[model samples]
Target chain A: MKKIVTIAREFGSGGRYIGKLAAEKLGYKFYDKELIMLMSKESGLSDEFIEEAGEKITNSMLFNVAMGGVYLNPGYNNTLMPLSDKLFVVQSNIIKRIAEEGPCVIVGRCADYSLKERGDCLNVFIHCPDEQKAERATKIYNMPEKNIEKEIKRRNKARSSHYYYYTGLDWGSPSNYDIVLNSGSLGADMCADIIADIAKNC
Target chain B: MKKIVTIAREFGSGGRYIGKLAAEKLGYKFYDKELIMLMSKESGLSDEFIEEAGEKITNSMLFNVAMGGVYLNPGYNNTLMPLSDKLFVVQSNIIKRIAEEGPCVIVGRCADYSLKERGDCLNVFIHCPDEQKAERATKIYNMPEKNIEKEIKRRNKARSSHYYYYTGLDWGSPSNYDIVLNSGSLGADMCADIIADIAKNC
Candidate 1:
């Protein structure tokens, strides 16, 4: 059977680039935000909304806490409760659809939890230090340094909440992920190579 | 902080033996049945009964189709349910307790799941060939050769069920573990040494 690789990651961890490199190296299809777009098409929701709410349970911690978290009205619902739920279901359905298609590299959106029972799947989590994240975000996305910090915090909050909402398990726990990579310390290419080797062995 | 080590394994894989050996090499406490015994003592349950119940989930799975599984009578429900729940809660609590005390070697019962958040914890899964299990079971336990196949299947059924029930996740999935070792191929001592080295690095 062809192999399925799922990559869950922190923002600015270079997971997308690493996944693309892995796909190119092994000649596999890559899925990232592309998955969100597909889910949007299927759910009849706008891609922009999916992009913003795709992998998050809350907007950001500060606002979430200030506005009673899930109680805040994101306009889709008085509290966005319905929209968030539908968005996750849509993403989950889309995830299974992609897994059914064949071997591919999936980035984020709790794809690991979606494909847990597949014997051929390899789940990887990519993480890096805060400083490294700020540096990378500033360099790649061309954001101001101060804004990079806020952006990093926002993305991480979203990723954690998204995973928690879906998997109902602690995110980044070594127990939840098969392999955890220190991408900032190891370098993205090295992390990708490690994953590729692990895929072969696994 | 002292390192933590978690060993997840299949039944008849000699996981406990390897864990003990690794602990000895590193001067860490080796906990196998000792953990159950400790939990029983802490929870005020008899050791024998708790031991039977602690791993009975495995036994149930093995014989589940034939025997629908053990359910405590309505009167015993209040007590036995807490026993079962306490087994897991105490297991998790003890793991955290041990990590707080110092490094320790924990075998089976999903210690890896228990210590997922500890930075120093080295989670490992010990595995071996099926044939090796049959060979060892017959030689070590004096099991009849004819019954070895049945024993292996039954034990695995129980183990997977036990692990899954407590961990709330699929068991024996390589991608869900940090490292997988073929102890039957590598030899237990070598496996222990290699694991010890890995633990040191962690």
Candidate 2:
């Protein structure tokens, strides 16, 4: 009732699915890859750029401080430096844009830290066991078991970095979230239903 | 199935109630006050002394250097201490005993941190909105509105202190928990059912 529900999820954890279902059940708008599209349309940024940067943390004082806050001149053929750097800028705007649109479920891309300024937002982290994630990732993404492990490790590390970069807090800490659910054990449908129920009751 | 579950919750969040329900639904024994009673019996410590010093933390160098290096002294009394300190010791031993007895749902007294070394333990934090907690305190504890504020603050502060003192992590942080539930909106019974289903499936 008084909070916007934001879902932070691990890769292949059915985060987007649960977010969509909960939003639909609660009659709230859902934002995921769609958020990147919206951000692209609004900011005149490319979908590719938006996607790479969205839901990530890029601005590290460590980087700026390390480089002595100096700008490098005439870098050639730098199509991508570190997507993480540009991620915070794009996703921060996207988060604000999504939150401004009204009460909705925004999936991952660091929306939790993005909308922390809003007192009415309820941040949640959705995760399942690693085995579940690996299985799901292998099926959905058509990746090998090793690839799933790599994907999970890489994405989880990225999100954790983004969280630490933006909020100066660990990504999965219960303290940062209003609710944390295990989709592996609960199933995505039940997780969504439970979340929707919580949203309605709130 | 591989891990134990740890619960650190607000005073009136019906932490014990939900924990017991989860254990029962799973056919696992529930350890609440019984844990302390058992530890008291096993450790030759009094109920009163164990409860007081068990949950509190000591900042000695033993725990600081290394976890295995740190030796926990769960005796009745050694020197100057507050009531919280006594509670910490008793609860700590109870947590260890329960974990040794095999997996069980242990509530409050910082059971989560106490059993952190016991591999495969799931840590959970349960919280509700301030308004709901105050209401529960008033209804269950028979306290007035003004008194409710103080009591809630005192208890939450105590939990926070007890948690931070031991974990080296901020209490209530989203990163610190596997799941954090806000039972305020859904109320206690519904909250219990949802968690029960989650645990079963999880």
Candidate 3:
């Protein structure tokens, strides 16, 4: 049985819901937005700040240049690190700690890349067609945007950029994940069921 | 129940094996290389020629330019159509006819694009990591290539180009398929099981 399941998803793809259902079916702890709370508590950063800056980087290149000087120091002082980099380190540590605790489902926040060294991790990506995503954003997410499609695209771009910034990997690339499921076509429940089944059997 | 299942895969991903297993489990007819015979009988092309040029295009751009003159005629006179285009049309018609008969599993030949209009079709793309694919090619396929990795890349590129030439869509894009399974991680049996389960319940 797989010990760790990481779900990376497109915005408005109902990925969090699928992760929750799969975790319930597998009887594993589920972490999504809860990770933000954990990170804030662990890092002494405000919850609101962690939520805002956790998964969305403003400019990765600039951040990299700014942090370049600090890389030479093996001691790696956290005070010298940028706030975004510090948050990522803290979040990654928490995720690793969670993995060590037991089998669990973690959604978003680059858990797949964070736990890449683990032998028993199952990485999944959930995506949907743009039309379906727009509909879900309006109906399920209740987003108050005039152009929900544009909003969805913007958020997805942010997520992708954030993922790339941290992991140096393309977000949502099938090669990076064990399985990629379309919630629109398979339905969220079936997607969750498949994840649970694969976790149990594979 | 899904009446049609279309699989697009990398060259050495064991996609055909997975499709066959899924079809058997679902009690559906499976088509892979068998479609070559059907196409040859319908198009009067030799099985050998179809096997060589069926899924690999020589040069799609030149073929497109040569066939451009025939597009104005809605009747699409076969005498004026290029041999490659003729082969594609015949193969697509055969695929459509097969779908019309009943539930079936088709491997390659862009069956997903051919049945894009069908509401009951499940399109799946199976992929594997390069290392795993190389190992499979060397061991399971018994390929006699000194550089198996290069051979695998060449075959995959040809498949991608052929797919793009015909469908004007990326072959393995997640949005174009319902689910993309990685056989390297999930194992072929579990991948087949997931496909069959999704087809039956979704």
lDDT of each: 0.72, 0.70, 0.88
Badly placed stretches (over 4 Å) of model 3 are A58-74, A77-79, B58-74, B77-79
Compose the digit string of candidate 1's lDDT tens values, residues B1-202.
Answer: 2377788876677878888999988888888888887887786667776676666554334443333333443555444333355556767887788778877988877777877776677667776767888887888877899978788888877777877877777676543555556676456876687567666643
Model 2 quality (TM-score): 0.62
Model 3 chain B: lowest-lDDT 10 consecutive positions: B66-75
Badly placed stretches (over 4 Å) of model 1 are: A58-81, B1-202
The CAPRI category of model 3 is high
Which scores better on DockQ, 1 or 2? Answer: 2
What is the DockQ score of candidate 2, to 2 decimals? 0.30
Chain B alone, candidate 3, TM-score of: 0.91
* Model 3 interface RMSD, one decimal: 0.7
Q: Give the per-residue Cα lDDT of candidate 2 at B82.
A: 41
Predicted candidate 1 versus true structure: per-residue lDDT over A17-95, tens digit per residue: 9998888877778998788779988977777767767776543556444433343345555645545666676787788
TM-scores for all predictions: 0.50, 0.62, 0.92
**For candidate 1, the TM-score of chain A alone relative to the native chain A:** 0.84
Pairwise DockQ winner, candidates 1 and 3: 3
Local error of candidate 2 at residue B200 (angstroms): 8.4
Using Cα atoms, each model's DockQ against the true complex is 0.04, 0.30, 0.83
Winner by TM-score between candidate 3 and candidate 1 = 3
Q: Which of the two candidates, 2 or 3, achieves a greater TM-score against the reference?
A: 3
DockQ-based ranking: 3, 2, 1
